[model samples]
Target: MATLPNPLPSLATSGLDLPPGTLVDTTLDGTWHEPLLWYADGPPADLRAWSRLRAAGRPLGLLPVLVTGGRRDQWPEEWDLCPDAASYPGDHDADEVLAGYWTEYAADEVAPEDTGPGTDGTGPDADGSEGPGPWPGLAPVPAREAAEDADTAAAGLAGVITADADEWLGGARTALVPARRSADIPAAIGWSGPMNHENDVARLCAVLRSWEDRYDARVVVLGFDTMIVSVGRPPGTIEEARALAAEHYAFCPDNIDQSPPYDLDAYAEKAVLNQEAWSFWWD
Candidate 1:
């Protein structure tokens, strides 16, 4: 069994951290300036901090809340699961949401039969072989590094970031990393399949637009779905964060019903094309 790393202390105290080894999760196009949103709503620890801050009128910088009861172990493949749920914010079930996200990507990568019992292989391999060999693993893009790359790619129009969330009184200790491994996304293709729906794409763009409007940041680094915006200032309350995210979600014009499930290959492309999605760091 793979031994999971302990939750990073920085993220534990605030809400985000830049612990080393954290992977980037977005595409090049997503490098636009905006904060990555991780939704959680469950236990007291998870709910209390978020609720207290929101109730007190803190912006929490787009930390959306979603309720679930599963453990992080349930979503081992998900990079957003917060390694150890014991230190997760408020009542949000980080595991379930991450699992759902990963499941969507997994669904897009392989056929039903290939994802059978005891099969760790995601979807069908490029060669359509189920036997374990070198199955593609979903990788997250880092925030700070990604920002640098995006800046380099955009010829100075964009810049990268790696700030300590705790540095800001109300900032979450979230760490941002680069979304793409290389500046060249198209040339760095890895997975195969559709990862997001039109609605999802639209929703992401809406969020990016909102963030861009609020902050001057723009570019997609990590994945297509993620958008990193340059914020002149970070929100201090959870309510403010929710308000921003809700507005972004509402901004999307696509229909969820018409959207297909997440595919690993598609998710990979999203991470590759959108630079913002991959850049994950504290606000």
Candidate 2:
């Protein structure tokens, strides 16, 4: 992946109020030349520290994320990161990537038993398979009539996750990653958590960068194979939610496919519409 000069190497003298931490440079192939990220030795005590770390990291072009050691006991050290396989986020366009995925998967999800004719309608194809006619396309950014700041909302959600450590994340650690933005965190560290869905993570990061502009979204928490994105401006109407649902479906199919009662409308209502956070798990 094309990247900026890594600042993690000089973190020790950067004058940031950091806790005892471990700089990780390990990858699936072997040890990376520079540290991929720096995670705290323990879980964050409260939201204040999370906010502080986020603020401290931003000046140095480092983005803060809550890294959880899940039930599987896989931390960043154990994660099989593949930086070599990733690409730069700026190299790909968000719409094209999402459109490609929607075309490949939407037919299976939206098309049902012999339904109708038009694009949105269901119908069988030349291969004798059912599908929705065409990709629904991307959703427009919801107007921020009274939206909260993205970082504030992210910190609030992080607070909730940390407060209920026993219930949610096994142990949440604050990790400072050298990234251009929050959306690029996955590609920066070459996180392969969603490999089944998208092999080159930078492509997914492209869509995330679009989300950051449209929804005031931030990548807040990441476990071994899970993610939680805090959305500051969510869809206010079902129309908007449904449109956004197509994008979500393309991004993570398990969110709708493996989920029982597998319905797009239901997924939009329960997971996307006006919700401050959207969580995903790859199986």
Candidate 3:
């Protein structure tokens, strides 16, 4: 068979540089009415807003949450994103699949050293008590596998490996591709609407206000259509989460979706193939 062209550039081997963008890291300690938010591009950390939120109540560890989808035929536990797990895929396993994909993306791109002990902007020797530092590299495991590993690993030092709402899972087909591409920059540049493509900016604002009152952490960055909030370990209930989603509408009034249900997975797959900066994740 003719050798397939290199699926994509390896972030590790490639000399590509991260385009100029904002970067923020914050902790989440409590619950918010509606906390889900996405931006075109601001800081790299902004792309990880959901990851930071799910991390609440979770111990610091190396668990990688996957993002998969739920089909009517497949129950919540029957997702087949992973080849060796339940021997089948389930509806709830979408997150697991997407997360696993992210791990591979990072391995191919992000340097093993950049995410370890001294790499984060927190400054080397900053955490005070430390030794060699966090793991140098992350292994992408299926959602079930990751959860099992997290329960076994006690440090609570888990990091996230997920996809935005619309990500594709082509398995080996994904090995050679990069999570993002530069060709789509023109479309993403010079924002003309709300974040996450939602039209409701005020909805987001309202969510933020509610979350702030309920949580005891800081809300550091708030863009026209994005937010970066913090919290500790114990997050609030699911009710508060809804509020956060509502608050998001405050920032972009049209953020809500009234269209018929669409295939987010298919969309995600195409996005990865294009290798373009996701308008949903960028500032």
Best by TM-score: 2
lDDT of 1 at 223: 24
Per-residue lDDT tens digits for candidate 1, residues 1-283, read: 0112212223335554212322223333432122223222212232134324232222222221111112222211132322111121222232333334334533443434334322223333457655222322221112222334322323221222222212221122222221221111111121111133221222233334334333333432232222233333333333233223222222221211123332222322332233233232211
Query: Which lDDT value does model 2 have at 133?
Result: 51
Better of 1 and 3 by TM-score: 1
Best-to-worst ranking by TM-score: 2, 1, 3
Give lDDT per model, in order: 0.27, 0.84, 0.23
Query: TM-score for all predictions?
Result: 0.22, 0.92, 0.20
Number of backbone-clashing residue pairs for each candidate, in the order shown = 111, 0, 90
Per-residue lDDT of candidate 3, residues 1-283 (tens digit): 0112221222223332333322111112222122111122222233343334334312311111222221222211221111111111112232233233233333333223323332211113346632222222211111121222212221121112122222222110000111111111111111122334322222222333333333322232222223233322112333233222222222222222221122122222332112211112222
**In model 2, where do residues sit more than 4 Å from their true spots?**
109-130, 144-146
Candidates arranged by lDDT, highest first? 2, 1, 3
